[model samples]
Target: MSWMPPDLPSAARARLEAARVLVVGLGGLGAHVALLLARSGVGHLVLADADRVEAANLSRQPYFPEHVGRLKAVALGELLQRIRPQMGVTLVPQFVAPDALPRLAAGCTAVVEAVDDAATKAALVEAAVAAGFRVVSASGIGGVGAGLAVRRLGRLVVVGDECTPCAGATPPLAPRVTAAAALQADVVVGWIVGNDSGTED
Candidate 1:
């Protein structure tokens, strides 16, 4: 518990602990974002990711060497619980299909979109907006030093360069990925704490 940050005081902590958040995609972005929200005291987390961990994923992801070949959602759900014993975590070992979006997002305080695919990111933002929940998403997050920025579009907050394609020459590195994830997590926490900044980063 000493490793955890100072508490948010009883009142604000209660508000945060009562919130439920759905984090899509357990890759470089989602994995770190989920952990951050948990550490920030978000009570219930719905983690969705169908992919299994591969050796290559360990480079930037939060997985251990032994975690390779394990289902990402399952592995992370277990770890997040160890970080916050009283937290409620639901693991969806399957991909977040369009039909399942509403059910998964219904009561969530916010949806954090951390998927690599551009189309999937767009779909998540759309669904979260339609369901009347704010979304924190990313774009052009592959390279380092492109610089990170926050852009608001209605109920959506996007972080990243806004132009560096993940499929571009530069592959995803940890510094930028975790930095962006931190920014995303901060936005989610800000919304829950009722001090969300609407300005650019």
Candidate 2:
């Protein structure tokens, strides 16, 4: 017998089989969410990220040290394929736009907002909501003082918080990034299992 719940309905099982999810950003949160979703049997994943992995990303990000000069989406795509050879994973190495939201959100059952920029996350949330897609986003997931949170925003849940920016607007640590990513995946899986343990924001 499979490890999945025996009591789950065929429809719920089918939901997993036919599920279409979009995960934006491939840094910390996005990487973790994509890995978990692939492992959880999500059928189709649309990954969007314009950034490439850096030598500094090896500590908390999912990619190996050798993957440092590669586009994040491509590197993660390879990893996802290795995780689930049968799953459909598409990597778009371009920044998603509000105009593209309709097409991207089309046929998608849910969208996970793992982007780091405040303006970008807000834009994605607005567009996804307008496109009628359920969304989960990250809030406060950076800083030496940071931690994870699961907050519900209607049918959506925002993970933690924004990444800490340097005076030159650069990211600092990896621990909080990984924590936030795990929380984002937790919310997504909770939704898959028909539970929303969001902190009720």
Candidate 3:
């Protein structure tokens, strides 16, 4: 696809095309991460989310007005398939528990944690690490800041400001949320490529 940069090394592109990533949560962060990964030619995506799209989600999420009331996993799976019909996508239309994360992530090349709940995020991170799956997670995108910071926690990489929590008074805006999601996507892509080339540190 033209979206895949011509300058990208064939090996990297091949790796991306062969990658199977698990994205937990189809909210603001996961939605964008899924779209970006599909466009970037990631071969397979496993999407999990139990929530249905609501009007409030239209503001910050990658869903259309018609998607309101539709299951996020189903909607996102359809969107990804539309974007890349050749891409393989699995939709788990249910909330994935932290304890179940390891089993879900075991078959994936990497995992992306984008759930709004901090406890769930932590649990998933722990589970992914224990399962030996490289994982990327988001921290704070609920505030006004558009800036993103990346932090490494063991085998997991975290993206977003370390300070702002979604529970804060500041409401989440598209710019900040999307920025964090983009960072998460980039990190996931990098991890896939690095692992494929045996260059991951």
TM-score of 1: 0.92
Candidate number achieving the greatest TM-score relative to the actual structure: 1
lDDT of 1: 0.86
lDDT of 3 by residue, 53-101 (tens): 9999999999999999999999999898889998999889998988888
Give me the runs in candidate 2 sitting further than 4 Å from their true place.
Answer: 1-11, 145-147, 161-172
59: Cα error in model 2, Å: 1.7
Please write out the lDDT profile of model 2 over residues 1-201, one tens digit for every residue.
Answer: 242467867776776767888998888888888988877778889999999999878877889988989999999999998887888988889999867877877888788887877898889889988888888887755456644566776877777654444565435467777777767777776666676667876
Query: Clashing pairs in model 3?
Result: none
**TM-score of predicted structure 2:** 0.85
Question: Per-residue lDDT tens digits of candidate 1, residues 45-84?
Answer: 9999999999999889999998999999999998998998
- The weakest ten consecutive residues by lDDT in model 2 span 161-170
What's the number of clashes in each of the models? 1, 8, 0
Model 3 residue runs over 4 Å out of place are 1-3, 165-168, 195-201
